[model samples]
Target: MNIFLINPPNCGRSIPEERYGITSLKQIFRGEPLALEELAGNLLEHNVRILDLKADPDGLDRELREFPPDVVGITGVTCEANTVLQLAVKVKEACRAIVVIGGIHASNDPGFFNHAAVDYIVVGIGKKAFADLVCALESDTDASALPGVMRTRPGRALERPPLRNTVADLVVEHSPNYELVSRYRSHYILEKLGITMGFVASAFGCPHRCLFCSIQGQTGGGYLTKPIETVVRDIGLLVDIPVIRLVDANTFGDVKRATALGRALFESGLKRQYLADIRSDTVVRHPEMLRQWQEAGLRAVIIGFEEIDDASLLAMNKANKASMNAEAIAILNDLGITIVGDFIISPDYDEDDFDRLGTYLDTRRIDLPMITVMTPLPGTALYLQEHHRIINHNLDYYTLTNAVTTTKLAEERFYSRYAALLANSHQNARL
Candidate 1:
């Protein structure tokens, strides 16, 4: 089947891309290409062609018109939902193709599938969720029966049992499909410093229930770990790649697993450089474990240091305090691990608060703390509670850096403060 997998024009990242030629943060803003690319390889057995639209330079209409696929699948994010809906509407109007949307956004909030243009909505892990959706679409079967899916029928809507959220048993082949891994080798090269980056998913769930985060709730809490050897063998697939990235909600969620994974990476002779995102509290829980990861090839960490003040911390449901972020930075930096820190400067903070954060970034010696306007995505608690306060409903404005809501600081000061942080991120990358 001819399949057109699109990353879509990142409406959320548009402002930043226009300003700096990069979306998200400069260092780790490579965007979420790895998941889609990997899914493509997993899908090749189905004889479907996959395209990474994020890396594509062609104009939207030009590409869609040129090569219409039997199905056009979009990985949905809250910030990108509006764009996805509009694009799906256009594609359906222009061609006879089924449209599907998946990813965390659809999984957390399947209601998005109500879009008439969307033929099927896949939830949960893409590997199984997508395959089932494709089979139903291709066979003209009752797609509503497919697990982890929601679809509309002639007069009623059909919602199916979410696929048993199992991380194991999904791998059809004994091999970890590198089909997706190979698509963006060049991009990983730059991120890993001319080294290829392999995706290594060690765990599936987060134990922490941060209100602002949907991960813990989505994965249903406990950390699901693969065999240490399986983890080792996965890295072996990317031994040729310069870097191995752990795509866990929190790879280091389990210290024993983290240590074993690190040990395996070291033993496999593939531990030159690795990267992953994990919370500061998790890191503090096991200092030696991180040291082992560093010894095993961990060069940097992408942490969620959301805010520095106690009230801000409590409001976000972050659970961890500002002090944890600071302590984590100190420990990790002392251990020689580079941290690509992330923080959201919301309407909740005044100019003084922002000034305090800026000073904290410098005083803490945070190499690159990527600061952003607190973005209330559609599915998150932030959006639900504060939807009325959101300044702009346009999905494009939800780009983490955009002030979708009136922040404590005005638009000008917020942007100016962000500009300073961006400079710091660039400087940190060089350092």
Candidate 2:
């Protein structure tokens, strides 16, 4: 089968930019679409071509006309859900290919893509499931019974399959087809440092279920890791890339496995710097594991210190405390590992709340403070709890920087404060 895997373009509308003319708040995503590449890797028997619309936004129509694939797979996040459907329509209009939509958004809300444009919706870690789906389609067999895959039915509730997120679903044996995106390699760079970066998924999903998190949809609330050797091999494949972001929700969820992986990376001497997500509690409990990883070229750790207070943390079901977050920052600083700290700003914040958060960031030694609005993304616990308050139903503004719910303060004032906080926090940002 001739398959075309598409990575959606830099999408998601910013409310601040669109409504208040706050241009600085709009986000521009830059990275290789590792998900699509992984799916292509498993479809080695087919002629696969990856069209990264992010790198070449105008190449889609040309590729469709020239390649004319038999199967078209599209992947995207919550904010890109609408755009993914539009792309699906374009593909449907251009060719006779079966359109499949998978990724964070589709996995979370499979029914959202059950329109005529999309034939199937893949719900979880889709490498193996997608391969099975492609095989079924090519052989004219029924694929509706595949686990973690749903045959789209418009205006009807989707019958979701039991998510089979075991290690087999990872299919780590076949490394991601990195060469498929080689032409877009130079476009994948660390914006701050202007150095090339590659993505290598050492793990998937997250152990913790923060109320506002969407990662659980990827693996049905399971934590799965690739073998250390597989991880090392994936990193090695990006030969010239200097930085490798282990694009896992939580890379060090399994402390023992993470420790061994660190030792293995150290032994393999891959010599590539890594940036990975680790919970603050993980850092507090297993500081030595981080130490070993730091020695294994772990340059930075992205920790989600979502809130500054315990009450807020508990409300969000973070299962962590502010003290743990502070201590982890100190420990990472002591170990010389740059900290890329993530902080969430609630729409319910008042003047005092903003002042308090700003004061907290001023006192912390975090290398980079990434602050985002407290968005109640659909399919998250927070969304369920706050759905009644959502005023913006548009998926385009679900960019995390936008508040889908009503703000405690005036709308424009809330965005102004957010923009100001971002500007102030980024004044001395690093890493």
Candidate 3:
């Protein structure tokens, strides 16, 4: 069977840009479709090809005409959910292939994709579940019984089998078929450093449930780590890529596993730099582990310093404190490891709030301060708590940079401040 996996294009409408003409706040993401690559790796028994719309947005129609796949799988985030449906329509019009939707959005809100254009939705970690789906499709058997696989029932609730995600769901043995995106390799560069970077999943599903976080939907609030050997092999498969971003919600969620993986990387003599996500508390508690990782060519760490105050931190249910975030910043700086700090701006921000956050970023040693508007994404605790306040129901404006709720300040003023903050913070971004 011919399988075609697609990564949605750089999408999502930016309120600041579209409304206030604040272009600085609009983000353009660039990366290999690692999720699609992972699913393709498991479907090696069948002919598979990847169409990275992020790299080649116009190539979709051409590819559909050329390959004419039997199964077309589309993956995207919440903001791209609407676009995924549009693409599904295009696929249906162009070919007789079955349309499947999966990825972060579908995994969290499976019912959203239960449209006539979509035939199935693979929830949770789809590496193994998607393979099982393919097999069922090939045999012309009922796939509705498969765990994490849902048959679309438009205008109705989607009832799926309970998926108890375990280590097997990762299917690390197959390794991501990185070669599938070889043609788009040059497009996957780290724009800040202008160097090629590859993604390798070291861990999945964060242990801590930050209210605003959607990672728990990936594995139903479980922390699973890929074997150290598997991680090493995946990095090795990238071959010529100089930097490897450990694309995990929290790379050090399991300190012991992270410590062992750090040691393994050191022993393997891979000589490649790595960037990974870590919690502030993890760094404060295990400074020694971070030091070990630094020695193993850990160049940078992305820390979620969501807020500058403990009260706001608690509001978001972020277990770590602002003090811990500051301490972690100091530790990483001392270790000569770059810090990519992630900060969230609330729509309730007044002049004083914006000033305080700006002051905090100005004083911090974060090499790259990534600031985003506080968004209550669907299928999150925050969303459940704040859904009533949502004014914009359109998924297109669900980009983290947009505030779907009413702002404490005037809407235009709110976006102006956001644009200013982003422009000021990125002035000295190093990585």
Best by lDDT: 2
Q: By lDDT, is 2 or 3 better?
A: 2
lDDT of 1 by residue, 4-96 (tens): 777765356444355444443422245435445545656654545445455553556776667767888887567777777887888888888
Candidate 2: clashing pairs of residues: none
lDDT tens digits, residue span 319-343, model 3: 8788899899999899899999999
Off by over 4 Å in 1: 13-28, 41-44, 59-68, 153-163, 169-176, 180-184, 189-196, 216-223, 424-431
- For model 1 the local lDDT of residue 192 reads 31
lDDT of 2 by residue, 1-431 (tens): 99999999999998888888999888796999999989988998999999999999999989998898999999999999999999999999988999999999998888789899899999899999999999999999999999988998898888877678899999988999999999999999999999999999999998888999999999988989999999999999999888999999899999889999999999997898999999999999998898899889999999999999999999999999999998999999999999999999999999899999989988889889998888888888988999899999999988899988889999899889989988998899899
Candidate 3, residue 258: the lDDT equals 96
TM-score for each model: 0.86, 0.99, 0.99
lDDT of every predicted structure (CA atoms): 0.68, 0.92, 0.92
| Pairs that collide, model 1 | 37-180, 38-180, 196-242, 347-407, 347-408
Q: List clash counts for every candidate, in order.
A: 5, 0, 0
Instruction: Name the better of 1 and 2 by TM-score.
Output: 2
